[model samples]
Target: MAGLRVDFGLLLEPLGFIKVLEWIFSIFVFATCGSFQGETTLVVSCKGVVNKTVTAAFAYPFRLNTVAFSAPDPEGCGGAWTDIYLVGNFSSSAQFFVTLAVLVFLYCIAALGVYIGYKHVYQQNSKFPLTDLAITVITAFLWMVGTFAWAKALANIKMATGASMIPGIETCKAPGITCRLASVTSMKTLNVSVVFGLLNMILWAGNIWFIYKDTNLFNKSNIISQSPAMYSARRI
Candidate 1:
């Protein structure tokens, strides 16, 4: 059997290099959003008790309404306190964003393999380039939609878990009781994910032109441009 030939030089080309970038950005998008775990603290001070801390932990998918934390011990607080829950249901948007990133990552890996190993076959077959162009366009659109939705969801998450949550807590309304947010997890990485998402969107959208150039339509257009008679006839 003949050995499989690999073209390392393709890695230097626009198609291969951009696919590598897409693969890397996809990893960032998923890792930052999928493996994340965080918590917010509510510090409660009562008339006769030391400040009691209540912590609500949440993670990826961000179904804030489903996450609840126990209130400070009622005996210590000198009044009954109910459990507290974070607000909002943002799982749909978060899940959609993460799932799309993962799919894009897989596609990039497969595309790079084809570029390196079977580039000759891909070039000779017009169908391959046409299919690639179609997929690239769809993926670009998905990145735009998913990234925007996820960004909006992230903002809502910040509001639900931050100081804005204090007013909604019943315990904070009692006389002589004061409640404030002590801390919340930093979303710096998630912010970076959004940035990467935007970059991926732009990269994929730009790549569409390059892929289009590989298709028969681009060649036909070029041929027509080179022949003024053909171009004039076509315009007629």
Candidate 2:
């Protein structure tokens, strides 16, 4: 009859403590990247009319190309320009990053529950530690892939929405119509998200060593190498 027994001491161990950090960092990774909403304004100066400020807004799961803003009115610009959209289709990378973070967050919660409440059962069962190690390794790899993709996507998003894009806009190229970027929402939080993502990867990768120690493989190797007599005695 193995019932849940809370063990507060596990919180001090590397396995328990690192899981806590992974849980917290996972939240940060998703909150900063998933909840992000940004806007960029393009100031359109045209002959014979007041300068028009066109605002383009974008948000999480950013599919920038899908986010269109009305081009400066043809009547106002003295020229025709269709709706302009931010560049790039970054949804795949963005969604992958956020989805991984959310899944990792949930995993951390469940892992912590196991660490705190079922510590004894977990230790007595080699399968639990082995599974934990394998999952940790996979998660670390995913974090690395997701973080890099998201970071690259973020850079592209900045370029697509910034002043550099002015030259690419047809209306901006029209004679007597000058366009300049007014402002773009700061991506500082998204940058932090990337940082947290990297940290999560490092933490999980490092935690692998600690988790592996609890696995039967590590114990068997130690018994064979460090105490061959004890190993043979156990076999006999």
Give the Cα error of residue 10 in candidate 2, in Å.
0.9
Per-candidate TM-scores read 0.91, 0.92
Q: Kindly list the per-residue Cα lDDT of model 2 for residues 4-41, writing each as its tens digit.
A: 99987888999999999999999999999999999999
TM-score of 2: 0.92
Give me the overall lDDT of model 2: 0.89
Model 2 regions lying over 4 Å from their true place: 71-79, 228-236
Q: lDDT per model, in order? A: 0.88, 0.89
Task: Write candidate 1's Cα lDDT for 1-236 as tens digits.
Answer: 12356886777988778889989999999999998899999888776655778889999999999998656775746654656788899999999999999999999988988888888777788998999999999999999999999999999999999998889877678777788888999999889889989999999999999889989989999887889986777999
Top TM-score: which candidate number? 2
